[model samples]
Target: MTTAATTETSAITETAALQDRLDFYWSGRAAEYHAHQVSGARAAIDRELWASVFATALDGCGREGSGALDILDVGTGSGYLASLLADAGHRVTGVDHSPGMVSAAQAAHPDLRVLIGDAHAPGILASSLDAVVNRYVLWTLPDPVAAARAWRTLLRPGGTVVAVDATWFPHGVDPAMKVPSADGEDAFVRTYDPATLGALPLGTAASMEDFAEVFLVAGFTDVIVKPLPQVAELDLRFGVAPGHESRPHFVVTARCP
Candidate 1:
């Protein structure tokens, strides 16, 4: 193979390897992750903020006038966002790369449709969805720009893509800094090498501006980026660990024109 071809092949191999690790990580923590979502006052407040964000994004997609818009929740771990959207009178289909996550989400929301699929390539029909929404998922992607382009293809003309993420570790921090377990249901401490964990493409985004650019380049228009006010306030009032308080979590919304 030529030098350029060799580089491309190496890149593909790395992405696949990283994806496998991610699936294993999430699948192993599926139960604990779901437990953390529903436990404590902070989690409740966060969920409310997510609901408001999704409602606004759906409204932007003209869902208020239209009835029950079809929304795809990519990387719908444990179906937290899917439940909220379905409760708000929208048709939701969730897709996750981890089978364990899919099963957990389905068990949590039996009525909701949840499938095991890659977020980078959701395999949904073109122009079949009014919106694609994900929370804390973008940073985990190996190629978020490519993922954004794939999601754009799934939306209708007026549809929108709403992503909720944060610059969790701007300074290239180690993943071991995270709390061992939030809910205490599963206390599995990650033993991955700090360097390897840090090198993962996830959480490398310096700012929301980088994400906005990705969306714009993917053919989205009228991109909006803003912090979740309630979350920020709660984070201050009931502060988390020392380092986590400063992480700026924000919502990014871009419309397909």
Candidate 2:
């Protein structure tokens, strides 16, 4: 896990700058992204899968929606998950530091609420949310622990926080293939520091343990870890597959104790 270290380049590539870049990146590719929302079928299929995950969490706690469940989607790049929850009757608030991404999300999912804000400081009230969800946004942050702790602060008592992100390390697999050039201005997906992304900074490959510990220390409970495996030829070929190199992605779920 990456520690909350300050970067000098923040002036040039701070969260705000990165957010702007991401916003521009997604806005330009929003159509293509929405088109490929699901591997097969309408974009909503991915939405359904996320809905299932969130519903499972809710169901595990034996709580049905009293009204619309108040949910927050942090780093909600395109607001797909928040839109899904909104469709499922959740009063969803999607936050991303990227305004362009938020705009695109709002444009596509007009019914859902989208906010441009930092996950580290969501501006949402602390201890007032029922659940906070982050999808594929973990690797982008410079400080995963502080970010997670910030999310924890937004949850109400017993509120569940679920984070799903790519947990693959860039092993020297097929290193001969040159990295592809992206079509638009937003080309390279920024990677974390070599240490955090490669081996654990202060620990082993089980570095997620460090991430889990951050939340534990901050006040989350019932932490559950799941590794999603990617095993198809296409998954491997895409290079974005959630395996060990891109297939076996891990997720951590915990409750605000």
Best by TM-score: 1
TM-score to true structure, per model: 0.87, 0.73
List candidate 2 segments past 4 Å from native: 1-31, 38-45, 60-67, 172-186, 189-211, 230-245
- After superposition, the stretches of candidate 1 with alpha carbons farther than 4 Å from their true spots are 1-7, 63-65, 175-178, 181-202, 241-246
Per-candidate local distance difference test: 0.78, 0.63
Q: Candidate 2 on 148-173: residue-level lDDT in tens?
A: 88888888778888777643443423
**Which candidate number would show the highest lDDT if scored against the true structure?**
1
**Candidate 1 lDDT over residue span 1-257, tens digit each:** 47998999988898788677667767777887788778876777777777877787667575455678899999999999999999989889999998778989999999999999888899899989999999988877767788899999998887889998887656655544554333232222242344444644555568878777779877889999987666667778877643244577788999988
